[model samples]
Target chain A: MEKVTININGADYSAEVEPRLLLVHFIRENANLTGTHVGCDTTSCGACTILLDGKPVKSCTMFAVQANGKHLTTVEGLAQNGKLSPVQEGFHEKHGLQCGFCTPGMMLTSVAFLKKNPNPTEGEIRWAISGNLCRCTGYVNIVEAVKYAAEKMKESNQ
Target chain B: MIPAQFEYAAPVSIPDALALLRSNPDAKILSGGQSLIPLIKFRLAQPALLVDINNIGGLDYIRAQDGWLKIGALVREADLEDSALVRRSYPLLYDTTLSVADPLVRNRATLAGNLAHADPANDHPATMLAYRAEVVATGVNISRVIPIDDFFRGLFATSLAPDELLTEVRVPMPKPRSGGAYLKMERKVGDFATAGVAVQLNLDAAGKIEQIGIGLTNVGLQALRAKRSEDALRGALPDAKGIERAARLAQEDCDPASDLRGSVEYKRNLVRVLTMRAIEKAIERAKGM
Candidate 1:
């Protein structure tokens, strides 16, 4: 077993895990942050997306030990003090989800993307979320949700 | 899917990593884990030990030195794609890096890891071949630089030994009046290329091709350099007829197998079309168009 300490949602949590334990499993099982879903264990689907050191990555593609001493942000971390983040609020406002299975990953992916590209075009938003798959909403509302979040974030900063 | 149980070591230095590899012959080096982890979950690879090298601090830079653009082994694909230096100095590499998986995967996928994994459908091999890049590998007893052409042996195979770690990739600076491009056709977003072509060409002062390199991906056991097409284009005027002839030669050079992406004939057609378009764009860029 390997001992790993990771900061998730701004709190430090340590656990003894097997070397093969994936970060997604660690987040869900050990840390008890189940907001990050595991839709496809393969890297093709972004349902397991999370922020590692502020950059978005598929947690399924990483081992818990690899994230030792790193800061990770999951969908749970996006809200603070019972208020939703801009991305979460935008999803609520734009009806970004239907079945909502792909929302956490989609929102986190957009959080990182909008941090880099705050004002993305419709095409750029589509391209940014290309790794994520949504079977229910057809992605038209997801794009609008990202745009709404971008505007909200820009307004807050101003 | 769960991976088989394995011992893991995170080494902070090159020597320690090499020593770990020497001690465990069946150990696999995990850089980004974008490819290795998925394969492990699928049970396609079952290594007894994993040597994690992400803690090595100096191996994540992109710089131009000694007439070559040196990208450290740990530099992620997203880093290369977003680098201003890469966009300005090596736009072809930038374009190719952008075509890799997607932004999320690119955030963790390393160029060295991608080449070392050596998936024929991956974009970097053919692009590296077009740039005549070299891979720098280091082991306990030796450090050698292997040219891209000789690095890939076959499907998912490379010249790197078990005890050696690839440290960096060095691409020669583009010559004056030279430009390059990488064009790929994928089945959908984030899918591997059905067919791809990377072309680099230099034009002489008189508007003829001085030097040329063409590489094809996903149509062979390895990234195939289109030597026949390159030979046909060298010293030839950049024109429609010459481009067509070279494209035909490129199509003839590939040995694609039918898969979900397309049939052998369809991939060959893509190779021809992409090669022609890449050559035309490269020629136009070479003349500063």
Candidate 2:
């Protein structure tokens, strides 16, 4: 077992975890932040997406030990001061989800993408979240949610 | 799914990592874990030890020197996709990097790791081959540069020894008036190529083909260079007839197996089509079109 300390949601948490423990499991079990879902443990599904040092990555594809001393942001970190983040609010406003199984990953992926590309077209938005799959909702509302979040974030920054 | 039990070590220096690999012959070097972790979870690979080199500094850079672009082993694919230098100097590599998996996977996947993994269907192998790149490998007390042509031996196999780690990839800068393109056919985004082709070519002052390299992906046990196709195009006009003939030669060189992506014949057909298209685009780019 290796001891590792990781900053998740801006808080430090340390644990003695097996070398084989995945970052997704560490976030769900050790940190006790279960908002990040694991749809496909394989890298195919981005259901376990999280921001590692402000860049999004699939948490299931990384070992817990590898994330030692790194900053990570999960779905639980999207909101602050008891209010939803713009991405979360966008999803709520635009009805971005139906079954909601892929919502956390989708929102996180969009949040990071919008930071990089603030004004994405419909095609660009579709390409940005292509890694995160949604079996339901047909992605129409999800695309709108990303656009809404982009506009909201832009308005606030102005 | 969790991976099997293993001992992990994060080495901060190259020598320390090499020493660990020398001691643990069954150890696997973890660069990004975008590919290795999935294999471990599926029980396809069960290494007794994992040497994590992420903490090692100075191994995640994109530098240009001595007429070559050197990309450190730890440089992430997303970094290459976003690199203005790559886009300006090696547009083919830049475009190819964008087609590798999705944004999330690219965020963590490394170029050297992708080549070292030696997945026949992966994108970088062919792109490297077309660019005439070299892999820098370091071991216990030795460091060597292996040409990309000789690096891939077979499926999931490389010339790299168990104790050696691929440290960087060096690609020679394209000559003036040279152009290249990478074309891939996949079922959807983030999918491996059903058939992929990378072509780099240069035209002479007289507008005849001077130098050309063709690399084929996902159509054999390893990424292969179409030497016959390249030979046919060199010193000849890149007209539609000559290109069609070269494309047929490239198609004949491939040995594809039927799978979910397509049948052997269908993949061969794709090789023909993509090769022709790649050659045309490369020629146009060479002529500054």
Clashes of each: 0, 0
Give per-residue CA lDDT, model 1, range B1-289, as digits (tens). 8899999999999999999999987899999988889999999999999999999889999999999999999999999988998988686798799999988999999999999999998899999999889999998988999999889999999999989999999989988998899999987878999999999888998999998888888999999999999999999888999999999999988999999888999999999999999999988888888
Candidate 1: residue B226 lDDT (0-100): 97
Q: Which residue segments of model 1 deviate by more than 4 Å?
A: none
lDDT of 1 at A149: 97
- Candidate 2, pairs of clashing residues: none
Weakest ten-residue segment in model 2 chain B by summed lDDT: B87-96
lDDT of 2 at A12: 100
Q: Which ten residues in a row have the lowest lDDT in candidate 1 chain B?
A: B86-95
lDDT of 2 by residue, A1-158 (tens): 89999999889999999999999999999999988998988898888999999898999999999999999999999999999999999999999999888999999999889989999999999988999999999999999999899999999999
Candidate No. with top lDDT: 1
| Candidate 2 structure quality by residue, lDDT tens digits, B1-289 | 9778998999999999988998877899999888899999998999999999999999999999998999999999999988999988787798788989998999999999999999999999998888889999998888999999889999999999998989989988888788899999999888999999999888888889988989999999999999899999999977999999999999999989999999999999999999999999988888788
